[model samples]
Target: LLSIVDKLSGDSGIGRTLRLAYDFRNAAAYLKYLWFSGEGEFKSFLPWGTLEPDALRGEIENILNEQSTDIEPALAGAVEQARHLKDAYKTPLAVDIALDRAYYRYAARNLPEGEYFSRWMAVMSDWANLKSFVRVINFGLNRKLFWETFAEGGDIPAGKFKEAIDLDTDSIPAVFIHTEYGSRLSDVIKTALGGEMSGLDLFFRAKLMELYRYTRYCIFGPELLWAYAMTKQEEINTLRVILRAKGAKLPFEMIREVISVVLE
Candidate 1:
């Protein structure tokens, strides 16, 4: 990327464009490191020694401010959607549904609303309906009870789990992060959805990438858009690791540790 920028230095107009391109590319690399590395290393990789949630929120705000200038039409709609998210809806599931709606509406506006879009819209609707039926009885916030309940594959005792839990027991998507094209996770989603599922790591990264691609032209875009857009190859690499561990039916502790690391 640096080389690409250097090669364009002689042309003033192109040089400025190349510089921004390089900055975006480098930012992506750092984002990848955050998702793929362990918590300790991720801390070491940052100046503040932590992936502060507030910092993330601030950074996103900054980006939106800049985007308002770079692309006013796109950013304006995004801001309105974000406003709706903040003042009205408070739950993750609610936020997710709103984003999905904004994304599909944006897609319909830009695309021909072909069969592909129709199918995905249906799938998204089904997922939303399933989310509504998720049994979210309160499980106490104790770590032991939380882990035990998750392991037992049943509802947690009152006060053990999060109040807004939306973990669907019937249709959990698993990504086989380590496996190749013929691997279980990739093949299943690919056959079911029908798309360019190859080249995907078929784990968290693949799921995220699908979200990113679907919503790139949307009004509000995805919440993880920055992380998804920035971290390309390396982000998917760690996803493969998580999927492989899952497929092996490893102990819950082992799987949880890997997931916590990836999502940190």
Candidate 2:
């Protein structure tokens, strides 16, 4: 990335974009734990951290005054959504959902437009909503409950999601048929509805791999860095999956089934 930026003319600040993003992105971790209870419940998607609730809130306040942007909407939405989540303090899901929505809607800044990474973030936001939506349907959750978590910047619209989620379970897949993800995700929805939940996880990884595989063919550019880093990350993720499965004594076929998606 520095190499690419160096080759550009003066006043090109793309080199600094990623660093600025990480500064606020890391701040999100502190915001998500604002309701933490030190009692050690499995409370978040990210790994547990040492910060207490007070400290987390203080950190969020600083970010809100600093970035003076997303940190507000992200937690502000959660403040409203919290009333609906009766056990909001016990689980971080509501806040996490709020953050997801605010993140795509406002958090993205300074991305290199037209780059794969920018598109990747938008698509990941969509997939995250899709993954969460699937659970809402399968678990009989209220369709309205998902609105706070709905993300922007994707091909799909929030109202489109609303209409789809309002449908009966069997008819839901039909709503996505004309969307970009239709052909690839139609069967994924069916498989998830069939209760093979692990398939959804594999599908997410597979779609990410498929969408970015072109980076691997770029022989002379910053994309080569993306391809190399993706390869390494996939290797580590694959090994981690295998180790966890083997540690649990999962059958050989099961281990193979999960790891196969890493490369595909």
lDDT of 2 by residue, 86-200 (tens): 2533345554555455445443543334557666666777777887788777767656657656666776677667778777778877777677676667777778876777877
How many Å off is the CA of 23 in candidate 2?
A: 9.2
**Candidate with maximal lDDT:** 2
The C-alpha stretches of model 2 lying farther than 4 A from their native spots are: 1-92, 102-107, 194-196
- The all-Cα superposition gives candidate 2 an RMSD in Å to the true structure of 6.0
lDDT of 2: 0.58
RMSD of model 1, in Å?
15.0
Instruction: Score residue 124 of candidate 1 by CA lDDT.
Output: 39
Candidate 2 — which pairs collide?
Answer: none
